[model samples]
Target: MCKRVTCPNDGKPTWWGCGAHIETALAGVATADRCDCPHVPVEGNPRMFEVKKTEDQATA
Candidate 1:
């Protein structure tokens, strides 16, 4: 399995790849081993999230 990591700059999830690939994908920016970094803040309440349907999905 590939290692799952979050991007340091955008806080987006990234899958495992070679060091060079990871670095290139991240644009040479360093990343943390885990999520919940300062760039991305987790909500204390789960209710804050809403499941929004896309236009196509909504129409379907």
Candidate 2:
């Protein structure tokens, strides 16, 4: 089962669990409150991590 988590990009609600229970984890969450940021794919590289900077943070 998936668990609810805060989106790192915008601090919106998101899911962090198996792909099978994505919809179940986000049930009842408002559409606007959902995080729509693109996520880095984790298929072959389980140990890989990525941190995306926002436009403001990129210019700093």
Candidate 3:
């Protein structure tokens, strides 16, 4: 089953689970409050969780 989680990028509500259960996990979350950040694969990392670097951080 999917679980509701906070988005690391914007601190908005998001899901952490299988793709199939995404909808179920965010069923009651408001659209505006939901995190719509696209998932980008981390280079040199093959793990379940990934840390995304912001634009400023990337350029630093």
Each model's lDDT comes to: 0.39, 0.65, 0.66
Q: Can you rank all candidates by TM-score, best first? A: 3, 2, 1
Residue clash pairs of candidate 1: none
Best-fitting candidate, scored by TM-score: 3
Model 2 weakest lDDT span, ten residues long: 45-54
Tell me the TM-score of each prediction against the true structure: 0.24, 0.58, 0.61
Candidate 3: regions farther than 4 A off:
40-60
Give the TM-score comparing model 3 with the true structure, all chains together.
0.61
Which pairs clash in model 2?
A: none
**Model 2 CA deviation exceeding 4 Å by range:** 41-60
Error of 2 at 42 (Å): 5.4
Point out the higher-scoring one by lDDT: 1 or 3.
3
Q: Please report the candidate that would top lDDT against the real structure.
A: 3
lDDT of 2 by residue, 1-60 (tens): 567777666788777654567678789998887887655535575443223447775586
lDDT of 1 at 29: 43
lDDT of 3 by residue, 4-51 (tens): 877776778777644557778789888887888765544654333333
Point out the worst 10-residue segment of candidate 1 by lDDT: 33-42
Lowest summed lDDT window (length 10), candidate 3: 44-53
